[model samples]
Target: MSPLVHSGPRAPLRWAACTCSRDPAFVVDPAVQLVFKHQGGYATLERVEDGGTSAHEKNEPRFRPYDGRVHGVLYRVTREDFEKLAKREGGYVVQELQVQTYDDSQYNALVFVSNPLFKLPQEVIPTEKYLARVREGARDNYLDPAYQAFLSGINTVPGAGLGSEYYNTPSKYMGYSFLVIAALITLAFFFQH
Candidate 1:
């Protein structure tokens, strides 16, 4: 039987703004910097901000001295769109997208940032094509019962649970303690003799 699909109203996009630094001295790096920019832009485009300050506000023309730091943006996107983008461009790794919501709202805006490993492309692939490929791949490889059983086996081996068995066993010091107690008893017996 096909997996149960939960159908519900689409979620709104949410967004936030943040600043990133790339200098070695700075904790934030180029990858993080791009994420801030992307997320900020995405949020602005969605217009999810109604009563709160946004990363776009800080980047406005009037707000001068925009060092692109100490500012970041966040927002949300449709699950379908997120999945499509993730498959097409190695998902969020190629373009890290951060999203958050303020209270409860109709739509959400997400922050888009460029990953240090990959620069944001001027032209983005459409979400449809990416999702199609992902679906195709899943059908081809992940649906096999054999493959699923193999994966389950790998995941359920003993001693693999919660790390190694040694973690639960007593330490060598405990053995030494028993030995010391035995030695003390022997000495007492000799004195009684």
Candidate 2:
């Protein structure tokens, strides 16, 4: 199964390995590598066929379909980094999810599940700034062409994505600096907002 999940009429979503690394983590299987996974589990827009509703609908997370989908990327991080992600706010619980690739290969990966106990009182809409970055990452990684088209087709927030460089540094030290910015950015976004 592809680590990427296409829930409905939404941009294809994938689990990118997030790191503070200055360079890309070679993910030989999925045919792509992640640069970052900024918004771990904020909400984005998604379309549902069959009028999706859970058996205990009230007990599950409510759906808020928007004009576009929320971009959730999985940054492949070290076990240490994974632990850090597990400690993020918004009550995101990290769990192992078996992702299926096109060749029917399965890879065990960590996915963040929103806590049922700490529900956001308001709708979780992604800022334009956040979604764009995600799209750029997907494009840069050479993901599926149709998926890229879907990302391009989504209605975007003009001047909505985070404008500044998430991190600026030289490329020489990339081998050692992968985790620095990821941890910092995740903290900044999680706490500052």
Q: Give the top-scoring candidate (lDDT).
A: 2
| Per-prediction tally of clashes | 35, 24
Model 1 earns a TM-score of 0.19
Top TM-score prediction, candidate number:
2
Give the per-residue lDDT of model 1 (tens digit) for 112-146: 33333233212122133322432343333333343
Give residue 99's lDDT in candidate 2 (0 to 100). 53
TM-scores for every predicted model: 0.19, 0.42
| lDDT (Cα, tens digit) per residue for candidate 2, span 1-193 | 1233322334233144332322222222221211121232243221223555321133222322222222233344567655544564344455554454434444565655444433233332334665566566666655555556655554433444433322222332353466788888899999988
> What is the model-wide C-alpha lDDT for candidate 1?
0.29
Worst 10 residues of 2 by lDDT: 29-38
In model 1, which regions exceed 4 Å deviation? 1-64, 67-75, 90-112, 119-193
